[model samples]
Target: MLRTVATRTRVGAVRVVQRRNASNVAVQNIESRWSTLSTAEQNTIAKQLEEAQKGDWKSLSLDEKKAAYYIAFGAHGPRAPITKPGHASKVVAGVAGVLAASSALFYAIRLGGQEKPHTISKEWEEATNEYLKSQNSNPISGISSEGYKGTGYVVSK
Candidate 1:
């Protein structure tokens, strides 16, 4: 009987200490929420976390990252200025204007009559060749005609 009384006293003292700790507002709030959750809800949350941990969580490719960002952070609607066919005509007109200006400038330059320098005739070439020949000797050595009236064979010593 005495040992049972002593054990009961110790259990009561432990319960008092636990009650004192549970008096904390933060601890009491967490305890109240946890007590309110059903066993099935907690089990479901645990299963979801376990499945997520099993999934791949490495760095993504550029394409995959862009796709995820666009899906999560897309803007409201179409946000650009619309254009029509007349815009193309404007570009064409600008190009044609440039071509016409260039053609006019070229035509004006051609009509201005630029004189080409005179090229020397073959007579000038013949005189120049003759002058060079007089300055430079004919390098032809001893020779004879078909009638045979010239130097003999150059026999070596």
Candidate 2:
């Protein structure tokens, strides 16, 4: 009988404490009407709430964490902006205007004046071939004399 009475008393005390905590006027009042508070008061309340939430969050299980994450970060609407035909036409016109302006600018700056078509003259080709032939004839430096040219080829019996 003593043990039963003690358990009931403890349960009653816990319920009373819970009711007292739940009856916080500030939390209730802020939920219904928040704009009346001054900036400093709002900041103070925010900090207190944040600290309390930090401790409460640590006790959450994995499923609770995932639920919170999905509620906060999951997308719940259309991924792309809905565009009517008129809006889409306007967008296309804007893009076409940009492209036309860019093409005009490129032609004005790069291809406005042309003096004869570009061509590799015979003299220029001959000069380039001469330079390449000279480079090819020059033996590579840093190779030992024994390792030069035909030294690595095996002689067949």
Which model scores highest in lDDT?
A: 2
How does each model score on lDDT?
A: 0.48, 0.53
- lDDT by residue for model 1 over 1-157, one digit each (tens)? 9999999999987874554343222222332344455777545433433333343534233333333333234331242235665998999999999999999999999899676432244555455545544555333532322343332332222
Q: Each candidate's TM vs. the true structure? A: 0.26, 0.31
Pairs clashing in candidate 1? none
- Candidate 2's C-alpha runs over 4 A off are 1-81, 111-119, 137-157
Q: Which digits, one per residue and each the tens of the lDDT, describe model 2 over residues 9-123?
A: 9998787456435423345435334455677765655554444346556644454344334324433224323665599789889999999999999989787677744334555
How close to the true structure is residue 58 of candidate 2, measured as C-alpha lDDT?
Answer: 61
Model 1 scores a TM of 0.26
Give residue 149's lDDT in candidate 2 (0 to 100).
50
